[model samples]
Target: MVIDMQKYFLNPVSHAYVESGPAITQKIKALQDCCLGRNIPVVQTRHINTKEGAKRMDRWWGDLITADNPLSQISNDLKCDKATIITKEQYDAFLDTGLEQLLKKQGISQLIITGVLTHLCCESTARSAFMRGFEVFFAVDGTASYNEQFHLAALLNLSHGFAVPVLTSEIIEQLESRT
Candidate 1:
């Protein structure tokens, strides 16, 4: 599952989605396709702001993207029929969200995560997922951030702590072998 990758980045002040995000997006598509082929479930998490929840928001300057903000919509290519579009107000996707229930419902024990701002949402979700007992595969090439340091730092930390950091191609190979 890819974590909260909404439009806070589009605003000049909050910063647009990580610059090289297309690389991650491309990898996501590949994973999505593979998952679809194998009858595996895929979930896409979005961080949305409700009227009450939009208060503490501030990634760049003072800009905030609420749930109603059209910019917060998932990218066009990422809108998938089989993918569950889960929304959350907290940094952790599981907080007050049906993510855990959905995972249980889908019987998903293994997750391939790819998304933006590796240090923040990505790493947080990875840790939480790991703690929740999910086998996590952190897609290095399928995740990006604003700066190189932030991206690498999060990857290293997650790899050492909870996730198994692997390239997109490696994930595909693993999936193929399972089939």
Candidate 2:
């Protein structure tokens, strides 16, 4: 599951929000394109918060996902519907979403992760999945943050503590080496 790669990430001032919009794009089309080629299910968890959540996440609240947030919409090329887009208020994807059940139904043993805010939502979701005994493969290059330190921190932590971290190229190689 990809976590919180919304238009808000383009902003430079929002707390924990990174600059991943048009100027300094993060996601490599190669990885998403690979999934598209294989028909791999790529579920995106977007953060569309209520007014309460917005007030609660104040200062920390990223303006993009709110009702009035201008950047809430996902990128045009990578559009996701309500069904494919799991909306959640919590940091963990499993808190209120049916992500676990979806994986189980599809026999998905592992999750290939990519998106924005590498150290926050990505880290939180990775931890949740790891605790639930799901194998997680974090895509290093496909994910990004405000800076390289935050991005590498998430990768190092997930790779050493929570899950195995793999580069986008590595995933493509593995995917290709198999069928």
Candidate 3:
């Protein structure tokens, strides 16, 4: 479950972008490659702004990820031809997006989450997945934030209850061994 990994939050040009974006992207790509090699389905998500109800968040952040804006585009490094891309209008990827349906269609009850803004979209999606009965494995170095404090805080909270926090190396090792 990759959440809100668009350029708007992972690129340096965005105001709330993560500084360690490159490293995080590399780790996520490695995990993605491992999953794809084993025929595991990968679900990637991007956040897009909507005039209907996402105006509140846009106003609060003083930024908007317009549907067709380049800033809303996912980084090339994290995208793959075989991956499923889900576009969301909110922080929680399952809120209105067909992510749940897609996962169900694939018989995916477990999620390995990686993406931007550890405390925001990533964390929110993790908790939501847990609530929806999916076992969530959250990647430590595969997720990033604007600062270390925010990143660590989210990981701590998530590992305590919402998800199992694992390193990218661990996930790749497990996935490889499974095959």
Against the hidden true structure, what lDDT does model 3 obtain? 0.86
Q: CA lDDT of 95 in candidate 2?
A: 75
Q: Which residue pairs come into collision in candidate 1? A: 9-15, 9-16
Which scores better on lDDT, 1 or 3? 3
Worst-scoring 10-residue span by lDDT in model 3: 9-18
**Residues 1-179 of candidate 2: C-alpha lDDT, one tens digit per residue:** 66776666655554535664343233545666667678777788778777665555655644436746766756554674422788887677787688899888988788887777678778888888888888988877677777888888888888887888877788888878777
Q: After superposition, how far is residue 115 of candidate 3 from its true place, in Å?
A: 0.7
Q: Quote the positional error of residue 6 for candidate 1 in Å.
A: 3.8
lDDT of 1 by residue, 35-76 (tens): 889988888988776656655666533665576777788777
Which consecutive 10 residues in model 1 have the weakest lDDT in total? Answer: 6-15
Q: After superposition, how far is residue 22 of candidate 1 from its true place, in Å?
A: 1.5
lDDT of each: 0.79, 0.72, 0.86
Error of 1 at 108 (Å): 1.7
- Which one is best on TM-score? 3
TM-score leaderboard ranking? 3, 1, 2
Tens digit per residue, CA lDDT, model 3, 79-171: 788988887878899988888988989899999989888898999999999999999999999998888999999999999999999999999
